[model samples]
Target: MTRVALMVAVMAVAAQIAIPLPFSPIPFTLQVLGVVLAGFLLGPRYGATAMVVYLLVGAVGVPVFANFRGGFDELVGPSGGYLLSYPFAALLAGLAAGAAANSPRGRALAVSFGWGCAALAVIYALGATQLAVVTQLPASVAVAQGVLPFVVFDLVKIGLAAAVATAAAPAIASSRA
Candidate 1:
């Protein structure tokens, strides 16, 4: 659909804002924001589908990943777990958004934030596990290097995503109607 394609394009643009860390292979990027937004806007099935399409697009060397780098290599690299977690994360977040539909704005925001945090937890778990496996590092080391550094930033991103989603979902739904 047009909206799904637009979200895929949004994710591609988000990947452009990458900041590589010195000690970690995972770079800071707005890809998570795009993921959260897709979930909040499109609901579970379509949100997850958008992520799958995005992954497929990147896997075929579309340069949609961070730093404009993409390929199957990106999906199997140290950061691959996080990359692969997108669909699940979007599904979880979309469920939260759907549950909060037609609720008061404050309640909707609360639900979005809670689910968004859960989604981030999914990303961290999958990402760290993969980082440890691919890089042959200890799990603690992987968590230390990969998950810890990003927590604060990701929390902020979740908050922002929740706010934006709560505010915009109604408008998006209306346009659909």
Candidate 2:
């Protein structure tokens, strides 16, 4: 429960750390990095629970979402899909980390990196689809508009998340033991 709350807080702070892109409705934030890390450290159920808590707080107007803005309206807005996808992404990332939980450090890092990529892909899939539907834009255009710009940055975030999870795996294992 404490870890879950801490993860929620981490996500809130991460959302505040953002750079708005003039070309996109969604800002570039480290919130997803928080999500990935939450999954890697907490496992799927707890990680996803953290995201749910974050969303509920944001929905209740806690300003925990991106750009210090939050509300039900934000959840149903242009970036809503991305917001909604957080739990699922976290779940996937957690599973990914769990898969390599017992591996050597280098192998764990590599496996976790793959899982991070998969988790990010899940986020993009849902986010891009909704962006296209909401904006009434062509799918390719929507992908170009919403995803292409962030691909590189998100990959970097994934790497960081994976590295941290790998580095802490021994402690995490010991704790579980």
Candidate 1, after superposition: displacement of residue 158 in Å?
0.7
TM-score of each: 0.96, 0.96
Best by lDDT: 1
Q: Per-residue lDDT tens digits of candidate 1, residues 1-177?
A: 988899999999998999999999899999888998889888888899999999999999999999999999999999999999999999998997777786776698999988899999999999999999999999999999999999999999999999998888779779868
TM-score attained by model 2: 0.96
Quote the positional error of residue 52 for candidate 2 in Å. Answer: 0.9
lDDT over C-alpha atoms for residue 31 of model 2: 80
Q: Give the Cα lDDT of each candidate.
A: 0.91, 0.89
**By summed lDDT, which 10 consecutive residues of candidate 1 come out lowest?**
97-106
How many clashing pairs per prediction, in order?
0, 0
